[model samples]
Target chain A: MITMTRETLFNLAMMAALILFPLWAWLADEPFMITLATKAVILALAGVGLNIALGLGGLVSLGHAAFFGIGGYAMGILASHAQNYTPLIETPFLIEGTKSMPVIWLVAVICSGLAALAIGALSLRTSGVYFIMITLAFGQMLFFFTISWPAYGGEDGLSIYVRNGFPGLNTLDPIQFYGICFALLALVLFFAARLARSPFGLALNAARQTAERVETVGISPYKLRLTAFVVSGMITGLAGALFADLNRFISPTMFSWQTSGEIMIFVIIGGVARLFGPVVGAVIFIALEHLLGGLSDYWHIYLGVLLLLIVLFARGGVIGTLTGREVAHD
Target chain B: MTDPMMTDPVLETRGISKTFGALQASKDISLTLMPGEIHALIGPNGAGKSTLIKQIAGGLRPDAGQVFLQGREVTGLDTPARARLGLGRTFQISALAMEDTVLQNAVLGALGASGRPFRFWRAALGDKDLRARAQDALERVGLQEHAATRTAELSHGQRRQLEVAVALTLRPKAFVMDEPMAGLGTGGSLRLTGFLDGLRAEAPILLVEHDMDAVFALADRISVLVYGEVIATGTVEEIRANPDVRSAYLGDEA
Candidate 1:
């Protein structure tokens, strides 16, 4: 048998807790708790997506909400059209809406990927604060565009009354839907793990630390960062699609910069580069929201204080504090 | 096959120049590195040795003239493109991924040369050949023992050795090195000088150094630069004898 390190053991325990917590909530007839877990899983998925860029590639994107919103809208527009039995566009190449989960996922991932390519191409031209502002600008542009776009419910947002069906599964059952989401989170976590250890990941990590060294080694940092950004956007877009389905609603708020910040917060608080850091972070954040939110109306005050503490004393983040070794120590 | 004694040279530059606003950092410098030979570029601080190296390595574009690896004009290509075409370089500063292991740094270099750094499906740690190649590179620098140690934890001299180990993975046709002995102690320089002496059999070296003793010991030919111009280029003894080189660069020390 292979020996498991403390990190691996901790990761396994966390995954188990994620699965069992929702199950126990369901058994205890707490639908609200189950829903909370589902939200955490989906949000963790988004965090995983961001971690690839922010942690691995060191590309801090403030416009990731653009991709997330694109995904939500992709699901919203397609499901809404399918429900109304309307063709999406009246062009010569007639386009129809889809209600299939697989189809929605494909569209959502593609739309976000395309949006990311465009945004990355423009934002990547500038580095550091410039990159951050350009990305935020793109997010704001998308947010306003969605508000103005009256065709798909605009500022009020679109609603999917019925959850889309996955193959061989009744997505109507809360447990089934949660299972699908949890499974996807696991799959993506697996992908993130594989990616973080791949040769590309090594090169990207090198690019993040020292572009000059990466260049002298015969690899383009620009190309690596761009690829990572696109992949990150696509994954976050997938999470957004699932999130919309879970809530049965999609709104312009999905495109807010605050969503981008929250997603980044998960990566930071958990552990920037650790595979399961975001998962642990999401759980901690949700627990804090539930526990502290009950005690005070201004919960953000506590959240801000906690974040300050983590940044000051526990800069390596929750996982870093637990392991003593840095998450970035590959 | 290559003519070691050929005048055509393995790497060459023609009239390369760069202007940083009012400051003309490098100006119309021409140089060459023949196969199986070490060509040293020696100049005092701010003599534009680094600027010329950057121009040749594609970090900075020369305001005038061209750079050639073999016979191809690569003036417009970027640094990675030049490196991909078998040109290797070592930075004066330790430009390694400090978060990774020494082995991982070498692996990245090998992956760039192998054209498979983009493979995302398989685990990078599972590639036997890649690991072996990286190990071989570390072994070349006599640092295979410390392969698994974090790069940040490596000592200064060890990091410098790791730099050469990383560069060697390129299997370069000619090396463009900038101040390889800038901060080396006596023993470190002696070891590196020995290593560099044996390395020319694999490929020619274009060395930029401040250490006159190491220069005279290793350089088959030397080019003395003064204020971004090649004041003299000749055999070590000839360069030592050149009055312009002595007055402008070497001074009374020559």
Candidate 2:
């Protein structure tokens, strides 16, 4: 029964922009613009994943890139084995690499979800700064572990010789690839919207607002948070899989704390808990990086200033300010 | 008066004591809440009334004691486990989900007893049974009209009523209410006193309160706690006539 507000309208417009810009780029034979749009959608998807934990569960995890990197490695390791015509593992039953994008995405989600389960189990035992530090440490551990892993390229990154195949399309086509990423972002946004209204979502929101009250209600906040964190990791892992395919490269940099920071940035800039907040935030972030990066070598200084202004003047991120609703408490 | 030697108390605390570093927050206090009776625990501030309630509600562990609900030891249980065993609670400071709607808050309380809140794909609004239970609880607290209203927007009295509504859905064997009448106006207090008086017929209440008027009007039996010790345990008139209680706690205040 909730009516569409200006924020919802803005969300719709941004989604349309994502599609139209990529389509326009394809028509104009501007491959770079299409690539840029794809990156934005992929990153937005990752932010949507984080919002489930940060905005809904109030779990401020700083190591989401570990999930992102798991997805990237899932794609990288599989594609590399397929390219070299080698099986992934020589166990009792041989395990082979996959060239299917869907299969790669599945593997990515599973790996990220399990990793999240383990990390969240330990990190969630602590709250506030301790949680932030524990998650950061986990991310760093993975980053170093990947760096020392010589089988997948060690400090040197792994590259996919060819983009993984979609069921019925040439993924090499800039427009087609862009379409997949955009559609996925839309899907996760839809899922996130559904989740925010579900019973689990209500309990998670309650836990975020009042942990003691939630406990009295007989729902464990820890269990709710762990579930949200794992789901978040799964979604981000999917996004990471696509990201690696987009660039045809995976490295320790994907697991870096800087990537985790950027992912958190997308959620904050978009509007925490706003369904399409991440999408809008990702669009702005990509626009800034592209436009400003073209204008000045030290575009980050300007980006920093802009981010500060938004944080200072706008209580809610872009979508929230436009919508006139700070957080989706509904 | 009820038999003082009754062995089958509804909710009993045996020799309960708790210490926080150098502070003896709760001393050896044994109390009983018989079925269908309001056992009001009244004390001055810093008398450790809150600590006793926390131990009963499983929020705090008594260094030495046993909390029994229906004669089953529950001292080792955590808050959630104790809540599942039918120990319903309301907070003095209005512990509620501020962002959630009245119905959502009610539903969360029911969600624990219902035992299946892990349904993520289906919309909560579509669940007819859960909504019905939530609506039913709201009706009990007279908040049925504001079912969709955000909890933050409710008045202080309304919020307290909603807390009762939330607890009612727990189907509790006993109620651990902390100052249910703390912020109520005279009218609201009277309304709640009537509600609590009626509520005892379903389950006993362990009320921790400072409001003497409400306590005298609602409590079936009164227990005075002073500096972590129970000064007097008796009926309303008995406590009123006790000189020791008059000097220590009631202080001619009651």
Candidate 3:
């Protein structure tokens, strides 16, 4: 007989809720709710990316917004070029722009992965506060650069008049877009779960606990962490591309430190190192914003208080508190 | 086949030296561990035993020295690289992953030994080969019963046993163990001493320890360090008789 732990059961329930709520909204003629769920799913994807590095690998990256912005820019640039009927580059050889979501996703993942390799190589040399500061500095540098650069509307941002195309689906429809985003989220979550059980994950987890012990066992913590960082950046970048397509726009705000913080908040608020932590966190965050925003403009103050409580008392976040600390075998 | 022990030392250090600003930690220290023998390194506190061990194990780079494992120079290698070269080590303080299971820690060491932990699909615990290697090591250390227990929950002595099990998974050519007998009760120490006595047949041990009784019982040879230098090196009887070693370390105990 197959048995499930409380945490596993909780994760399944959360996934079910995510899928059903949008369906319910679609049936009730509330398209805005579907859009909001899409937003939550996109943010959850980004959070999962950060969770791989921060939670499992114990790398506290404060500059993930750089990858997110790069992804957003990838979609923006390609779509803008295609919309204007201009080649992206014509200097030596012609490289055409693309309105294809798959192409944009690939470009975004590769670009962000390369960026992560460079940033992680340098920043991973230092640990704790220095690592955090270096990552934050990198994010801020990209944010300022995007604002100053005039290629894709600079601070004004870029807008795609129509959503990018998939093979056959109408991406302009909110529920269809939600379905795509949700599917990707499910796939990434599955990958993340498997990754956490792999040998690399074991070594990475051990490195997080005692690096010296890991070294004595014959694995380089630096290489392990760098690889994780690159994969993490690629996942976040994919989320950024999806987010840009959903809104039909891309902006410098995507690169802002606040975006990075929000992504981190999803991991922390859901539960650090938990597979479905980001999903629960994203849902609650969106729900709070929607419900609390109508009550007062001081919604952020309430969020700050909630964050403080989670950090102080509820160290495990919602899932962790409910399920309790997991035994090694369990 | 000719015994390699007769031709070359299993592990050797040549004129290793280290200084921190003004205080010298290790000075012109050289040592060797022959195959199938336990070489005990003993000294009073702050006599640079730990620093010398760190240099030998690749945790610290000596200012002037060369370390060789099986006649190959390893001075330039880092800890992990040296470990990959079959130089297994354990810490003075237990360094097992506290959150992981005992088997998980052993599996990790075996994974390191395999030199291919990058595979991302299959579960580590589910790997039959890795599981067998880990289980065999644990069984050798009499820790097979605690395979699923969280490492943090183990008693201090059991943690020490797990450390050896972890090192055993490396299938190492030599072992560098720092104070493996620290924090053990008398019964635990006796049992571990007996276990280590038998372990010498698998791989030579360079044991840095404080427990003289365990040292005298297990070591094939002894080296005493004092004021950043090896004051004496000899068999157990000669070490007990050496005036310099007695005064510098053993003293009244001798």
Per-residue CA lDDT of model 3 for B1-254, tens digit only, reads: 39664658999999999999999999999999998899999999999999998998898999998999999999999999999999999999999889999999999999999999898989999999999999999999999999999998999999999999999999999999999999999999999999999989988999999999999999999999998999889999999999888777777978
lDDT by residue (A114-161, candidate 1, tens digit) is 999999988898999999999999999999999999988898988889
How high is the DockQ of candidate 2? Answer: 0.75
* Model 3 / residue B22 / CA error / Å: 0.3
Worst 10 residues of 1 chain B by lDDT: B1-10
Please, what is the TM-score per model? 0.98, 0.96, 0.99
What is the per-residue lDDT of model 2 for residues A1-330, given as tens digits with 9 covering 90 to 100? 978767767878887888788888888999999999999999999999999999899899999999999999999999999999999999888999999999999999999999999999999999999999999999999999999999999899998889999999999998899889988888898899899999899889889999998888777889999999999999999999999999999999999999999898888887887888778778888899999998998987886786787789875788777878645444
Per-residue lDDT for B214 in model 1? 89
Candidate 3 DockQ score?
0.88
Every model's DockQ, to 2 decimals? 0.80, 0.75, 0.88
The total of clashing pairs for model 2 equals: 0
Distance from true position, residue B73, model 3, in Å?
A: 0.3
Candidate 1 residue B188 Cα shift, in angstroms, is 1.2
Question: Taking the tens digit of each residue's C-alpha lDDT, what string does model 1 give over B46-74?
Answer: 99988898998989989899999988899
The candidate that achieves the highest TM-score relative to the unseen native structure:
3
Q: Ten-residue segment with the worst summed lDDT in candidate 2 chain A?
A: A321-330
